[model samples]
Target: MISFFKKFEEEGILGINRRIGEYILPYNPREYYPLVDDKWKTAELARQFHVPMPYHYGLVNTFGGIRNTRELIKGRPGFVVKPANGGMGNGILVITGESEYDNGSIIFHKADEKKITEKELYHHVSGILSGLYSLDGNSDSCILQERLECHTFFREISFRGIPDIRVIVFLGYPVMAMLRLPTKESGGRANLHQGALGVGIDLRTGTLTHSVCNDKIIHLHPDTKRKLSGRVIPCWEIILQMASRCFDMSGLGYLGVDIVLDELRGPLLLEMNARPGLGIQIANRMGLLDRLRLVERIHDPADGPKDRVHRMLQEL
Candidate 1:
């Protein structure tokens, strides 16, 4: 048991203390946080930078604007309602389909076939505007984003919700990446703590190599029961390029870029995280310290996004 921990330490498994003391504290500045913290701001910045992302319907900023929900998302066949300041996938309501009832009310269905009324949907969005999901009880807004359809390849492995790729970028280079797949236990949300499966991806090959669920290594998905390893992620190079570009857009030295693959749209940037979690180490069964150190040693401060990605692929 001690040797197991010793090997982890020797391989540079980055602990929370080392992450903060070494990376977050020195590399990330407070001012750059807002770029990734607020969902709306992140969307706007991605638009300004020409980063591909899901189509945004509109924002519900005030109580009065809540009435515009129907009109805002009228033509959107499917949409995601989420708090602009929410984290860990909280307060996110995904409406996959809608139908009108005889009483003139609309019914929305979730991935699990759970049905909700339009009034219930309005109340959920109202809670978001009331700051129910915000980090510090600050006023929040509701963003209506286009729902993404998972690529056919992932649909076989995922139980319900769409899977997303998380690429950790350090010094403008993509150091590590993992595929976050939603599970029945996670309520179809791609969050590790919520019981989602975190599968490690080969940095150069884009193939699934390892997987973890509830901190235990697994070879098959609990719900889908499909083999989790050896599957190749679609749009692998494009996803890494998109993640590398986020460094310039957000100006954060250490960043986590979340991207999703839409069946028709290829890869789209979903969100960004300044303080990315450490579960990725468990998924990869390796420490992030070594990968991060490699980035620092090879990354050039003057390299552009394209040059940085090229250098990283060649050297790392």
Candidate 2:
């Protein structure tokens, strides 16, 4: 079943790219993303816009910097060490807390048995510094960010790690949203193709629609068998507002805004994608071409950010 779906996805790549072009009309992924993919710039924008983001402790941009990673995270119990240039949830370590091993060594547990020794952690950071996670084998930076406590709304569904809300903002209006739930198969991460569930969310009501797992429609979770519908996401208004604001901030006609509901901080912006995935269409069981056309007719990028957000709410 998985293989069949995998082949289907591979076959649909061209169609996916075409749809993205249709939705993103004037913008091209290769042109915009490469320019905005800089992690430091993204963080600065989020901060300037009052978009809550995880607290970054330090960044390791060189071999000498990697040597200081342990010292940087010495007292921080819960934090995440990630590669700035990594894609598809790769090279991310979510330190749950701390633990003492039988060998009298301290270790950090990320979910399940995903533990890392001090030496292993150093080696991993070194690998990132050496360009293992960067595009074109270029040297990379490792960012250590404060681990957010996942909100209770996701406790029942998520296995570990933070599950993000992906909002597809078209021309400064939020057109669609999907709650990506993490699972054991995804190593407690929310990459849907890795066996997580993509639950479509109604923008107006904040209620869940049907869910898709591995490209197959399912009413219940594969692991928990919990019915997928009727799940109400918290902070729906804030999520939509943040997504719309990104369009104004970046002057991009279309984009995806990833937000996570932190237990203490409420909704926080994780990252912005110039070209979001087409799987959101499958999850919503709707076509992006139609939604894009509708939003384009309604939204005016010339409008100020506050007015644009109000216009989006009215359109919704």
Best by TM-score: 1
- TM-score, each model? 0.96, 0.88
- Evaluate model 1: give its lDDT: 0.91
Point out where model 2 deviates above 4 Å: 1-14, 20-25, 28-35, 100-104, 302-310, 313-316
User: Which ranges of candidate 1 are over 4 A from the true structure?
Assistant: 1-7
In candidate 2, which residue pairs clash? none
How many angstroms is residue 139 displaced in model 2 relative to the true structure, after the best TM-score fit?
Answer: 1.6
Instruction: Determine which window of 10 residues in candidate 1 has minimal summed lDDT.
Output: 307-316
lDDT tens digits, residues 1-316, model 1?
9998788789889888888888988989989898898989999999999999898899999999999999998977899999998898989998899999788989999877799999999999999999999866888999999999889989889988999999999988998899999999988999898999999998888999899999999999999889988888887888888999999999899989999999999999999999899999888878898888888789788898888888888976
| Each prediction's whole-model lDDT (CA) | 0.91, 0.77
